[model samples]
Target: MNGSQALSITDRKADEQAMIAAHNCAVARSFHSYFNQYILTDHERGYIVIDEGDYGALPQHLMDRVVDAVPSKMIDEH
Candidate 1:
């Protein structure tokens, strides 16, 4: 989706589902940091952390990384 069509997480669960559909990809939003870290191995993992956080919680750098992320043939061991 474009900037004008960007989503806001007013309702956590619903917004998350919408974001996933907008991206047309698999996404994971969790309160556990470990869950986000673990999904790094999956290419389509749209990891979002909601550990006592809301829409504006994640840093811009992380968001940038998320946007830049693309599927890769090489797997991440970390």
Candidate 2:
């Protein structure tokens, strides 16, 4: 999504759900982070699609990543 159309997290460092998207630990950037951000909308509930997380995939793989998160500011509604 473009910057203007993209969602905003007022508190980038908020404690709701924090999965670092970048680091120097040599992790691949090919994976996606905060997927719930795409599924969540204002005044809506957001959750992980697969509770088990990354079925059949090896741990730490890109498909293995699942984040049940919305913007930090939106977390208060829950």
Candidate 3:
């Protein structure tokens, strides 16, 4: 890769790492319980997951906020 392309990849990786850290910190402070927070991205799609196990385990307000933040197409049906 060219120098510019290499730099771009480095910058993107740094940005993604920052995003992951921020999301994990937010989930920890906001949820007040154990949960897995993931920010996944690929060629086709990107999405965030705040999994608190079963669907019923997730708070409605938090779920609503998550849904509102993410695009419908990014969310997996099942």
TM-score for every candidate vs. truth? 0.21, 0.17, 0.33
Q: Which lDDT values do the candidates have, in the order given?
A: 0.38, 0.30, 0.46
Q: Candidate 1, residue 53: CA error in Å?
A: 33
lDDT of 2: 0.30
Question: Which digits, one per residue and each the tens of the lDDT, describe model 2 over residues 32-68?
Answer: 3322231111223222233122334324543334433
lDDT of 1 at 13: 72
Model 1: per-residue lDDT, tens digit, 1-78? 766675566656765664555343322333222223211122354343232233344566455545322222233467
Candidate 1 contains a number of clashing pairs equal to 0
lDDT value, residue 25 of candidate 2: 14
Measured by TM-score, the strongest candidate is: 3
- lDDT tens per residue, model 3, 1-78: 765555478777876776666565545544443434433333333334554433545565555545312212223335
For model 3, the stretches where C-alpha displacement exceeds 4 angstroms are 1-7, 33-78
What is residue 67's positional error in candidate 3, in angstroms?
13
Give the TM-score comparing model 2 with the true structure, all chains together: 0.17
